[model samples]
Target chain A: MRDRPATEARILEAAQAILIAAGPGGFGVNAVAREAGVDKQLIYRYYGGLDGLLEALGVRLAQWWQEKLMAGLPQTPVENYGELIELLALQLLHIVRSEPLALQSLLWELTGSESFVKSLSASRARAYGAWMAGVRGGLEPPEDVDAPAINALLIAAISQIALAGRQADTIIGLPTNDPATWDRLEKSLLRLVRGVYARP
Target chain B: MRDRPATEARILEAAQAILIAAGPGGFGVNAVAREAGVDKQLIYRYYGGLDGLLEALGVRLAQWWQEKLMAGLPQTPVENYGELIELLALQLLHIVRSEPLALQSLLWELTGSESFVKSLSASRARAYGAWMAGVRGGLEPPEDVDAPAINALLIAAISQIALAGRQADTIIGLPTNDPATWDRLEKSLLRLVRGVYARP
Candidate 1:
């Protein structure tokens, strides 16, 4: 119990590494303990078990993701939603590339666990709802905007980009610090968002 | 040998099943032979080794994927790229959902093998080059729509949506045939495309 706080952080870090290397199915207690250089019993005592560890990690990752997503957006609101989307896409690519392991772990759990999947959907719904509230600069989506639909689309699109960024990293064996492909991705996303948000 | 064709087909089928169940690393000669209900020795007689099997599978699967992707496009090109994008999104969602096993295998190899990744990049370049040739239907892009840039965006956006669709199937345990989600996605994508293709 004395080492509980540090143990939690260590377990999360170790879990992220295990997930990055072997995905969700490979997240074993022994592996995590060994990776963390901690006692197995300490992991059990600190996080309760694998499920608890995953739950904590999921919550942590979601908050981090939302914060990173919201970081590039202006505090108030903008008339052009495309601008926001473009920023969001670049920010998303940046964040995922920065923290590939955590994002990959979340994605793996999204595929591997039903409970985790539900949690992810709920969390996403909440985040998008919040984002939409801010999208029109406090006012709801304009009549022609189809706010809910737009929100869903943006969430889906950005989520895909973030995931694809991870896949791109794996494919080209690029380091997180490299911004070459990211520059290309950012340009493309800007065009796509402009397509969605620019006036007809 | 006399059963070369049969042996090759069996190997391909086995690789697909393994990809669906355990991904690329789990695909071994022993597993493939077992799954195909054939002698292990036959794998060597026909394919020479595991790498051969992977190469043969890659060629076969890539060809199959290309055919499947081209199956549902409008017979003739439409002036409004937005409508075409919607159609393409729906078609892609259908393809990704229905062919999860194949997609999984293709993605696994695309990221895992260096030579395969190079070929995949070349294939993508060709597809993008072709798409850019048709970027101008009636509307003009706000900025110069370079082939690489447009391709990167279009490919990223489409890939993201497809990945979402797959997750809805494999992770969220949602019905892959749910037209409502696809319909919503199509509208959003169409709007995005329109926003991009609109006159500056």
Candidate 2:
């Protein structure tokens, strides 16, 4: 007898592989079932269909992000706001840069599909919010700082550049695909972070 | 007996419609050919198939941005760097929020597809650089400022928030989908812009 939980996990893994390989265009029932080594009917019978399975994939993604964001980092509590921003910014960049799956989720989120927005993206945002609360510790930005908005802008921009940086294509003239160019971007990001959050 | 330029133009418009409505997943030769009321063979014959057509779409999109960014604004030159940032930010938000095609392009670019990266994105980058040069009117950010990275970050973040805000979705706790929340985001964006470009 197939292990139901194991089978379900396998299906999700296959879905991620497919997304990483073929993107959302190739995401469908028959292909996912084939990838999972299961019958096509099983996805519907098991997860209630593609949207449901996609939700599960989203949940899995949230969990993956939760783990990966903290993976192998020093346990030392971040010293100050600048340090915190540096940690958050650098780690976010590293994760998005290294993982095609992370990039996929962002791209998928941009589609504004109800299934993804309601299920997948919601799960991710919740996980991200919780993750931020955890990592932020007792440290806080200056009172005048619109920390959430500023951080959001920085995070969004950095992620966008990283997405484009994968190619030789430029994001507003930053040749981010080049390693030296990427290094300069990193420096500029930290500078902006430090500049914005710098205490008067 | 059709004007070749007009026929090609119609095909491009249809492709843009498909991209705007269905996102990239619905973008295909058959669909575009049908939308344009042209034979499928014409697509292969005229534009060298989808990639060439998409490149044209990118060029057309660049022209659209160039026109729309100054669509009905006052002829008065942007007096300072801060004003320029505000004009650029607000106008960009309006365009991206109202125009699904812009959002779609960003999402497609994120997919890291070679066809998209090499052609469509290159066209976009050129237009964006040209647009920036035209708008700035001799004002410059402070020497300490990393204008490209900073502007890229703000633009990236605002576009992202706009993308998510189409639905009642939260981007890291800001309820961007809500109009009031979005207002605050805009305010925060301007605040970040001013803070980023503040001079001694």
Candidate 2, superposed: residue stretches over 4 Å from native: A1-4, A72-74, A79-82, A112-117, B1-5, B70-74, B78-83, B112-117
Residue runs of model 1 more than 4 Å from their true location after superposition: A1-5, A20-26, A41-49, A73-83, A131-136, A159-162, A165-181, B1-4, B20-30, B41-48, B77-90, B105-143, B168-178
What's the residue-level lDDT of B72 in candidate 2? 35
Give the TM-score of chain B in candidate 2: 0.85
Candidate 2 Cα deviation (angstroms), residue B61:
1.8
**Model 2 docking category:** medium
lDDT of each: 0.59, 0.74
Error of 1 at B79 (Å): 4.5
List, residue by residue over A47-72, the lDDT tens digit for candidate 1. 88877777776777667656655666
lDDT of 2 by residue, B78-125 (tens): 778767777778878877877777777766666646564556566665
lDDT of 2 by residue, A1-200 (tens): 47998888888889999988766667889889889899878789889998888878877877787787767354788777767777788888888878988877776676646565556666665665666677777888888878877777777777677666665467766675568766767777786687678844
CA displacement after TM-score superposition, residue B171 of candidate 1 (Å): 11
